[model samples]
Target: MSIGETPARPRKKKKHTGRNIILSVVALIVIAGLVAGGYLWNLGRTFDSNSSKITDAFPAEETRPEVKEESKDAINILLLGTDTREVRSDETEEDEFATLPGGGRSDTMMLVHIPSDRKNVFVTSIMRDTWLDIPGVGTAKINRAFASGGVPKAVETLEGLFGIRINHVASIDFEGFKGMTDAVGGVTINNPIAFRPVHNKSYYFPEGEQKLNGEEALAFVRERKAFTGAGGSDYRRVKNQQLFVKAILGQILSKETLTSPAKIQGIVQEMAPYVAVDESLDATKVAGIASSMLNIRSSDMEFFTLPNNGPGRSADGQSIVIPDMDTIEKFGEALQRDTVDQFVASTDLSK
Candidate 1:
């Protein structure tokens, strides 16, 4: 069977809405993994049994990078947030069927790299529109990897780009993002600069510390049209995503959240139905992975974007982000050698 043929479930075509853009559904999985411990037995079992499982979501082993003995204990997880909703009535056919795969483009792609020592967790966000080569397809936007061949193509494209062996993969539905925020009783983030978005003009976000409910939080991370100028939209959007993730982490680690078993349980159970992970990451494996990172705290996580040249037009006139390949090449080498700290320090990761 073709790699993309392994179905998680039948796709139900939902109408396109402003909330279609998912920001941190996969990040919730990472949070779940970090929180897993003696308490994780139930979380793991609940998550494993309730969530969908993607069969054969990875490419052939021969084509993947081998983990160096020195970095044997390190893990790289590809976290993707996808939207399968149909295009709006006003959209063109090209917009609706722009890619081969029916699962739709991955709205968010983050590589969560956990070093062997587990002292720090690094998250590198890959711009969805970064022009890159997709396996079995010519060069195109990196997001197209998911749209063209589902999880396997997305995995293959990333491995080929970073030369890193992905230990696991996870995709989450956008609805999970809202459920998780509500389950945690909401998250607060300090807004650096804010404005009302075009989609929802009535929702005014002032510049200051802001407390956001589930629906408002979704709008906060997904607003790009409010940022004017070329390249400004995605640049600010990515930063918002990182900031929101950090806030969620803080809330999760807070006394209120940690002390309340009901809250944590609510988060896992509420989010489980919207998540899908590789077949290998079953209950036992998820719990094991989580237990190993039990020492991880919100302060230890570092989030940054993969360096990219400023936004520009493609040869065909489509707007795209030019990746900094030279730096990316070195980044790949660091992943293999487990010297990402050194690489991150020396590299100019400015977008």
Candidate 2:
């Protein structure tokens, strides 16, 4: 250790330190870019996917009646869940449960109203078996609208049924629903009964609060027989579906999911393929709606089934849900005024 040796200069240490700092900065930049890019990409994708394709689906400017004061607020959308069993022919059997070879009836029909004020989201679930006008096809089951003429006809039928203007349509298949549930690491459902379906022989889930996987979650919502164990029926099934939607929305908004890159990507990818939007639904509209929806919470969402009692034997001896005209009219008025309180006040939830 001679003094002229310059204390054996720590060149190696300096070089290592420099390399480590550079690597650390690069990693941070990459991660930040990914997070930012994912957020922007997802926002853009949702906007594009949800825009309406059919501008004429609504009346033209000339056709719309002119008023002293025009309403610039609020938008209404139709959310459809189709029961198609086949999406891809080559996919494994397990993944093919939700995909159907051809288009089938819609298992779920929901009309979502997002007011211009962005205060809350109103959801009304229509029964699949509800008898309604099928446009050119005469009277038929409401679910048949989608199968007969696709989304446009479905929208038309719904518009006619409810007497409200629908601005957009978002239709997703069964597989997409399952994929979303799995991507979010499953959802928690409060089971009100302890019953099992014949198909799910080994899938015995006890009644109570339980976490559900993709398959189990699907079965939970689709199980009419199980919900009936405690005197359940289609009405009970509808209630469960509403609860499931709320649970899903809550899960999606949690910080655990919003901040996870891998989970977000998985969800977006799964949702992209099976979702179809009207041609008019573009990225801008979707982004605007999503930005507005950020403030909405599970508490802000309201779900209710159309008022109806059990099915009755018609003149042909076929069972059909007899719609109570008075109840339906009350529901329609509440919707037209965008007042859930008005609707729920007059209606009975215990039916």
TM-scores, all candidates, are: 0.83, 0.74
lDDT of 2 by residue, 1-351 (tens): 576676455887699779999999999999987877677677567535532243334433442322211223557788776566543454333223322123433567788877667877777787766767778888766656655665666777766665667777777666676888999999998877676764567777677999888888777676665554322456677777788888888888788987886786677776766776666666666656777777777788778777776566556664456666678777665556665555776678555
- Each prediction's whole-model lDDT (CA): 0.79, 0.67
By summed lDDT, the worst window of 10 consecutive residues in model 2 runs over 63-72
Candidate 2 TM-score over all chains jointly: 0.74
Best model per lDDT:
1
Residue 318 alpha-carbon offset, candidate 2, angstroms: 2.2
Regions of candidate 2 where Cα sits further than 4 Å from its true position: 1-38, 42-72, 86-104, 225-233
